[model samples]
Target: MTNTDVGITDDEGSTMTLGEGRTPLIPSTHDENLYYKHEGLNPSGSFKDRGTALTVSKALEEGIEKLHVCSSGNAALSLAVYTRRAGLECVCHVPEQTSESKKQLMEALGATLVEYDGVYEDIFHELREKDLDGWNVTPGVSNTSLEAYERIAAEILAQVVPEQVIVPCGNGTNLAGIWRGFEKHGESPAMVGVQMKGAAPIKKALEEEKSHAVVEDPGESLAEGIIASESFNCAEATDAITASDGRLEVITETELEAGLRELVREGILPEPTSAAVKPVADRYDGVTVAVVTGSGLKNYTELRELC
Candidate 1:
């Protein structure tokens, strides 16, 4: 969990110091030799830290102070913590239904939380209308987040060298970042994307061979982090998947919940979003690592009740 823990060798034979990049890739208790990249162990308790650190570091370099972002949970909390750490202020606009634990985490990190009575996209629309004097808005996936997430692919390439990388897709930044990282590092692993059955925008877009915005589902699942009413980069994410020769699939809530239980029984406490990687674990025959994207601590009570 420190800089000295992981190795990085550049193409020019030069090396940049590694961040807290190498997380434990432990074997799954249920499956034979399958492994899980325990992203819950990340500094921010989610894989978002890898990118948020890069983004906030850049923001600091740019002399930005106050920042704003909208999210259902993980990304907002991650950015909030990083911003606080960087001595900058962050205003997180979250949906009213966002977990209390996540809200508490944000508050404890010294970020202001603005709870709106609608979906994240709605809050995003509201934010767009606001006149910000100098505060930078974390452009969800299309901005620095995309570049930050690239590290996930780099870590996977070094550790597992899997035939395929399965991630729970939401904003598409993680998929795009990971894909670009693997491509840049000359490590081309097949990238499989997983989404909730009801909110499978990427899968629907692939099947229809057209980019269509996903309508919000009224029904709920534990994978709250991946529920976006509409996605701006769905096409781009799909393109990345197709280019990598990977497929995107939808896993039912029942399957994801079962995965959550399995993870807990194995002592890998993961958020519901993290658990979505479970159903798709069986697809790839070779080495496969599912990104456990958030800590159960972010939603301990709910995750425990589900168990």
Candidate 2:
């Protein structure tokens, strides 16, 4: 199925796409009841394309000629591709340490790049300092992107209505969006959010029963996609998790490494962070679908070293 079969349509009644949606839902190689929604197959090699396609389409229709975004890697790359396709200028500010593979491709897609010395929050802070305002296409911050992300759940329902959906949670928009999507269809599934140990502020906050808190000493992992030092959408994320009767998990470096090996053996090479759900999904009862957020190709070099 094409993205148009399952995505938001424009005012012209056509979904602007670069083959961004209708990703295949593949059965797992090991667990019979578990499946993988391989979003890495998206044009930008991450689920971020789903958001970019819709948001950029809406922006283009509104005569938006330029876009601004702050991303870890995948989001910037996806924005770069969509904006270029729309013939709009894109400026992306990303951490200096982003994977070279992702950064190089963003530039090749005609996005002007400004590298910063820290993580997403730091870069975003500096962007705020510049007093520059335009269309911000970051994945978790806007309504259109959330609407686009809801399509993932819609497609999953069409493919297989599992008892639960597992997602790698950074800011929790994808999890929340999917829950909302299922709600729009009048169905709800158990939502599960997983994060790498060091970067899981959401998990920590939930565990502590607090509204918002930062990890005092964050650790490093190759799963940079889901590694937000602190979450910006904590309330939205927690609300979704709470409303859906979903639970949170924090996986270790050992678990991330082992999960990567297990998933690779199962014929899925997810980025290290996206594999955070494998161990949990392996033990969950009933049908479960794990959303593999991005491809290992986004950081093949670092992943190979980790493996």
Candidate 3:
């Protein structure tokens, strides 16, 4: 994949090489013409590491002593690891329904985990309303994550020039980053955003041609991190999709399950969030790149059973 060395490194003099970034843009065995960006290889076992590291670092740079964030799973884990490294206190409000392993990882990294009863977005709103005592609140989907995704896009462009790029949509930060990264470099790749069927606000917005916040249902899926019903950047997401000549594709539970299974068969274990990108890959018939956003290890048992 096309990449910039400067974007991937965690600043200079940092020797923490979890071998993050520069992941393979592999040609699928099933279809030689297709490519996959195996982002599951990132440190902290998810693509969110890219953004979390940068966000945490920037927060530290700004002299923020403590941090708080609301997440479904992946982002919390990413922040936990990064904040621990940066010697910053972290308090994460996560959905009560998030995975056990994810919760364990958060605590293991020394983050104070507060489980909330309502939706993920509700927790974000709650955090926003409360007095954090000057704790740097990591916006659930910050622009810094886009910088991380930019590194991903840069690498993809370098490795193999693709006609299309697909990513799982949650807060739409990943899509926004990829769109902006390529655009900054004077490149335009057809960008497809995927969401779980009934949970897809981005797809709905595109279909309706207007963007609005959505309230998520109580039930949960394996793609816990992307269980967002409301997008902080709904209009921007809509604009990116329209501008890219791309569309949002929402996959049903059955379709998502199948997609998860396919990744395992190929020796890639994708978490629920990453599984959303699969159908988009299947739909497009070209040198398409689908970002496998997180490790199957996050949902290892579930994936193994399904496989």
* TM-score versus the correct structure, for each prediction: 0.89, 0.91, 0.91
Which residue window of length 10 is worst by lDDT in model 2? 5-14
Better of 1 and 3 by TM-score: 3
Q: Which of 1 and 2 is the better model by lDDT?
A: 2
What lDDT does candidate 1 reach at residue 75?
A: 76
* Candidate 2 RMSD to the correct structure: 2.8
User: Relative to the true structure, how large is the alpha-carbon lDDT of every model?
Assistant: 0.76, 0.80, 0.76
Deviation of model 1 at 147, angstroms: 1.7
Q: Provide the lDDT at 192 for model 3.
A: 90
Candidate 3 lDDT, tens digit per residue, 191-247? Answer: 898877678888777777787657557256777756667776677677878888988
Error of 1 at 218 (Å): 5.3
Which predicted model would earn the best lDDT?
Answer: 2
Clashing pairs in 2: none
In candidate 3, how many clashes are counted? 9
Question: What's the best-to-worst order under lDDT?
Answer: 2, 3, 1
Q: How accurate is candidate 2 locally (lDDT)?
A: 0.80
